[model samples]
Target: MTTPYPRVELGDLPEIDVFSEEFRAAPWEVTSRIHSPNGLARSSRGIEGLTYQSAHTVLGDRRPRIGFDEMYQATGFDESSPVYQAAVTSINNLEGDVHKVLRETLGRYFTRDFVQTLRPVVRSIAEEILDGFVPGEPVDIATRLVGKIPSRLFASLVGAPLGDAEFLEKTSDALLTVFYMDNANHEVVEKAYAGLAAYVEDLIRVRQSSPGDDVVSYLLDVERSGRITRHDVIVNVTALLRASTDTTAGQMGLVIAELAERPDVWERCHSEPGIIPAAVMEAVRWRTGAWSILRVVREDMNILGTPVPAGTDFFGLAVAAHRDPEAYPDPHTFRLDRRRPKPTLNWGMGVHYCLGKPIAQVEMEEVVRLLTERWTGVHLAKPLVTDGEPVNSRPLTALIGHTPR
Candidate 1:
């Protein structure tokens, strides 16, 4: 198979590197230029990679697997290490019946109705955190408000002790660095993963001895059936914890910041809570936390006429796909009225779509709803800035000043 567009060589396009400072500084600009003639391009980078920018072609294609074990082995981690075990065995890495079983088992807690049961838990946490912020004062909402909600909520969901949320959040950050940072220290990441494993093990032991209506107890029940082991419980719990923490926090930062900048948007959401859900979807489409999904090709195939070799790593760039004009009219502008003809790839596509999406949407809507209800207006003290390496792009720091309505 051959692409209708000419195959562009990586040597001819050096600026497309995701890790490059130039690209990170202006990713949308670079992605836009590279995708002018085609939706897919083969990277000259030695990793045997493909870069995809179009949502029209990339989503719902299952040939490209996350290849968690492949990446773990490629990175030279010891197979027996807790970090390696967690990385390679987590449900995020599993495929076929294994993935299906684990996902179905966990689905009991992550469903829309189940997540709604936690609304009181989420509102309580939001109220406590907001109570600490004085009206008309500048605070780094990025760190103080947006960051804490998800961490605390995840802690509550898994039945971790009340005071353990902050510690777990920090550990999750460190663990994420191992995957997101190009030059992250292996020893440091391993230590963080080890710490998380020990904590999860303790939590599991508590659940086993004294069951509760929480995720750990549910996993323990599954384990009792001999379908899964204690180790599986630890890994699955850690996966939920990690996915729920920083990624959600980052997306919250973007949503809140945007609302602050656009009073029309804020007032609309404030006056009509029903519209907050659509606003959250727009926020995700506009400023995605998951910039890309890493996958490895299982067999030789063609992507929009471009020949792809087996065992090649592919980067399905959600950042670029969300900005594709073909999928979104006036793609850069955030609009609640926008009807997505094709589903947004922010939460992912196909079987690997994010299971935490339901809870995440509820959390985002609540934060926006509660913040608007409490504050007349939320404005940035300084322009919200996004700066980071390719592996961990996020808002830097901005003090959000607010006034009582």
Candidate 2:
């Protein structure tokens, strides 16, 4: 089989230049430009590796190592190196084991029953935060409110102490920022890994001595039962915090920004209060916190007649796919009434789909519902725009102002 390294002019495609000032100034426009059907076509450089059947052949039921190896290589981590191998093994093991254990271990914490039970607590927290918001003040809602709520909620869910929650949130954000761009410096990754490892190690010991109803405690119990090892516990806990904090915080900011820009949607939610769940899902489809999932072609394949060679890198751009006009008519416009489409592959399509989707949906729905019920005539202080290179949807930078009617 021919190696499918099809060559194309890279500069013709809107560069995925994440750090450009123009991108930072007008992210949504850049996103729209990059994700346009034509833009997507241009962005399809090195796509000789993406065949129609590529999804199945490349990202099948079982996890493949070729993608991990390629990612390591692209990131300058040697695939043959012991550290890279260990990290890959840890990642793969965590993905599979966490999914399986999620039902038994974390299912209760995030279940509909539990979420409904926690609604009052979540609302109380929301109100407390809003009550403290000096009305008419231009707040960095993203950093102040959006990031705080989810981090605290997640920490409570995992039984991490409140103080440590703040530290974990900061570390998680830095780690995610680095990971998302694949630009994490060695020191940054090392520090994050070390800090998180130390924190989890301490939590595991504490939970061992005094088990609680929270997830960490439960996972410790599971480890004791030989269902998982100490290393498994650490990897899964690290995954949970990383997955829960950054994405949720990012989505919260994006949704708030979206609502701020579209007063009609905000007013609808404020008036009805029941449509927030649908709105949250719509926002998720629009923002898509995690941008792309990388896969590797496992064998020779053909996707829509596009040839894919074994071991070639494949990228499924979730944000771009969500905006496909064929998938959603006039995809640019945000419509709450847009017949709640099936959960966009925003989370993912196949076996490697995000494990925390249910929890995220619940958290988003709760936050939106609470915000709508508590405020009216919520208005934006500045025009909300996607101002940055398209990294997962838009990196909702600044919300100049907001008010409660």
Candidate 3:
């Protein structure tokens, strides 16, 4: 069942470590070094869809059964690994009817209506965090502002006390390393998976007795109806906690950090609140913390004329793809109001498209709105520092000051 197309092993393509410092700092430059006419990247991690079309295809293609479980295993994670064991049955790893069932079951809670209901909540949280900052004073915006909102929001959404935000933030980063194969084996990852699981179990128990209009309470109701298992409620809720925290935190932090560096953009976004939604899109495309979407195929498949053997890790490298000149003009410059053929790939695409996207979007949009309201402009107090990995590009430090309103 194979042709003679010389199965292109991405590892052999020379000088591209999609997870390396170079790739982190300059994904487009690193990807461009691999001159594959077929649009395949040489990154050892796997085949990359560096262009917008190929990235969309690689991420959105369901014919060959694209999934993360296979890719995680390809990275050598087995049942022996705690994180693997916990997530293997979660919706992130499920596919077909099983995936559809769980996805649809969870989808009810994330409806546009539900997300809008949370906006006032998002605004309330944002304002409280902003209130802590003194005028004309530099603050650790990364930790105090950008990092606080989403994790706090996760707690509120699940009906967990706001005090748990600290735990969620800690484990959320440890849990986030799952996306990066190099960082997945860190000692904290196992503890994160285990700890979050325990915390969620307690959360489910509380919601069982005091059910309310929250995600956990809703899942508990579904559990009683025999639509989903208790374990499903526990694992997926933990998964949602893991899902909602760090990525949104990272993106928010990046936007703040990047905007600090670009006062022109900041000034405009501040002056015209209506442009924040577009600014969010432009900023996400500019330096998305979400670098790639990890996917694997069960059978050998051809991607953009590049032959990929069965069970190989196929990455839709959003870090590079979003910057593809063909996809967006002047791709490097962070300008809003630019029209594009497709929506941003940062949230991913197709059936496995992020279930929490609406929540994340509302959180991010509301954040930009909040910041613009409080400050006429923002400028960095210090240089931004990050892990620099294409996936989960976390800002380690982002000190900044907001101009008085």
Candidate 4:
């Protein structure tokens, strides 16, 4: 028998709603029409004989025959076409090289041992941000606190000069906007792409002339060894900036919003600092920085009784899955003390899982722990919503005006 197509309404999908007090207290009360297990099956069925559209496929579809029109028709964005083969090839070639170089070059700095050393540094940054807080006035926390810290940290990690922080943040935001926002202004995407490429090219040259103890220097060294090329360095650096900047910053903003809305949960974290990690994990599950990961079926097969054809596009909806009541009891509630043991698909699953999971966890844990310990009575001055464009589902975007005790 032919596969029965899953009929579902997109509007019925559970979105990340931080503004609803009811949602904050009990988010899982809202059922997700599509979730991990069932959503995967639904996506598999939808792509049968149809082209897959989305940002993730932009690089994976290696052939030119997979043109922009087809890509736009399937995915919504014309830029999703793998038009930048040179860039894509360079990135693929350098993935192994960069992973190794990161291990050798900055491994000492980011290791669990060294990360422990940075706790003081992380806390200092947190304090510095809080120091600038004006209790009664509205402030965009994303700009004032969350966005700035990660951008600075990422720049320092890459050995980019302090002056470049603003530029880096702008470029990262522009790039994220290109993918995340609906009707992403084409001009912004092109301008951002060009600006970032120029910046990376310039940085690569500087690092080549004067090597340092940073990832850029490592890339320069590898380029000199002929194992990787200049093209490889630039592309990988772009990917690094995109990955490092947006995801963490976005999640940080979401966590702040969560804490602000649920003072009880924030108090729980304050009383028990050790729960910061679990709180971060739950926040990620609740907001899920990256909404979905796209993968192509290698062969025709059945998943959740849905017949997926070969080359079909399947998406793992992490945000939906994380909210699944079957997995997380009272999935929507911000209950720090909940005894239910639930696995989050926020970082993804299987081999394609995020490589930066450890780093992200560490950064989040430190931020939450320090924020809770240092401040009280934090609340939002504006509505919290998803940034960029709304894709499979909107992810939490920004949080503004955090009051200090």
Tell me each candidate's TM-score: 0.90, 0.79, 0.91, 0.73
| Tens-digit per-residue lDDT, 22-110, candidate 2 | 64454334555653212322233343111212323334435443254444444455766533443455433335555466445555555
Output the TM-score of candidate 2: 0.79
* lDDT of candidate 2 at residue 68, scale 0 to 100: 45
> lDDT winner among the candidates?
3
The lDDT for every candidate, in the order shown, is 0.74, 0.60, 0.77, 0.57
- Comparing 1 and 3 on TM-score, the stronger one: 3
Winner of 1 and 3 under lDDT: 3
Model 4's alpha-carbon lDDT is 0.57
Better of 1 and 2 by lDDT: 1
Model 3 lDDT at residue 210: 86
Give the per-residue lDDT of model 4 (tens digit) for 302-390: 54334545665554445555666556777667666667555565454443345556776777788888778766757776576654322
lDDT of 1 by residue, 113-149 (tens): 8989877788889989999987789999888888888
- In candidate 2 the C-alpha lDDT for residue 347 amounts to 62
Q: In angstroms, how far off is 117's CA in candidate 2? A: 3.6
Q: Could you list the CA RMSD of all candidates, in the order they appear?
A: 2.9, 5.2, 3.0, 7.0
